[model samples]
Target: MKSLLFHRLALSKDKKGVLELSEQGQEIQKADDILKDPYVLEFLNIPESYQFLESELEEKLISNLQHFLLELGKGFTFEKRQYRISISGKHFFVDLVFYHRILKCFVLIDLKGGEVTHQDVGQMNLYLNYFKKEVNTEGDNEPIGIVLGAAKDHVLVEYATESISNQLFISKYQLYLPDKKQLENELNKLLDDEHDNSASR
Candidate 1:
């Protein structure tokens, strides 16, 4: 029963001791439902100290497309890379484009080798607006944009995205695998806290 429930939605606890679910119950209703917060890109196998350019990162992901897709979670279908969009004879390229079968929306990803800036957020918003106005056909949902970076300033991201009407998000990617023991310890701590809370009540 738990496995079946998980097939519909994932349940986990956050640092504040709040239990969170991936979705309401059985279906993906929004972009956040399908996206991971910090995407793990350990399969790329780039060294921790290596300072790679955005283009190199794209190439590595394309070369390992299958693993990349799996890391992106379910329902993503690759559409194009360096997808071109023109404005007043000026051409801009999106790093990666994907279509979510379940969400019925185009997903645009902009890669940043360093920390994300407000300009990056603005650029992604522009891409999303263009997709909505010029690219989306009838019955398609609003396009979603992800500004992917190696690091993010949460306060800046909040300020940059707070007023945007477009469906946009900021996330980080790690080249190396996370420490399993640390994660296990955190999870165990949360579980213990929950158990103690229940008993106290």
Candidate 2:
């Protein structure tokens, strides 16, 4: 999750920019593996049709802390929400913070309601640096970052409000934010397609 969770295609590449995040001498592929692909949020119970604010999503996840931890895998313990840090005298806040017992690192998460930008990744990197310098202890591994984001398709979103003769915007709105099952299906399909493409290449 060090990068913006790009749209459901689960693509590591951004349509707009390249995301390179390995420290020299580090195994790049394993670094990629550090991020849980898809970072499942079925626990949040957000309907696929619902377009939500990042704050709202954060609140839901915090409320369902147990389920959220389960999705994050073992060893994650919630530290704080809206954890703050000061840099050059300016204060910055990370959305959600956790400590991974197994990884021996701080896991910083920034929630994005829409597609993630290169600037977002840079921002997370800055958070990691801040923790490395100011927060983490000498024994801790480098902090891990995740930009949990929705890789929403603009085309579908733009047309979402548009309706044919049979239905109105209200009807369309009700159908927005898909149910968990449909969302999972969509995610799996994208993963499958990506795997197929990679295999062929």
Which candidate achieves the best TM-score against the true structure? 1
Q: Write the per-residue lDDT of candidate 2 for residues 1-201, one digit (tens) a residue.
A: 322333323333442222222222112222233444456676576777787888998898899999778656557789999998888899888999998776688888888887765566667777877888889897887777777666634364346424322111110111123466766776787778779989999
Clash totals for all models, in order? 0, 11
All models: lDDT? Answer: 0.83, 0.63
The Cα error of candidate 2 at residue 93, in Å, is: 0.8
Candidate 1 structure, TM-score to reference = 0.82
Model 2 misplacement above 4 A? 1-34, 152-201
TM-scores of the candidates are: 0.82, 0.61
On lDDT, the leading prediction is 1
Model 1 agreement with the true structure over 80-197: per-residue lDDT tens digits:
9999999999999999999999999999999999999999999999999999999999999999999999999999999999999998999888775446675566567667887999
Candidate 1 CA-lDDT value: 0.83
Sliding window of 10 residues with minimal summed lDDT for model 1? 2-11
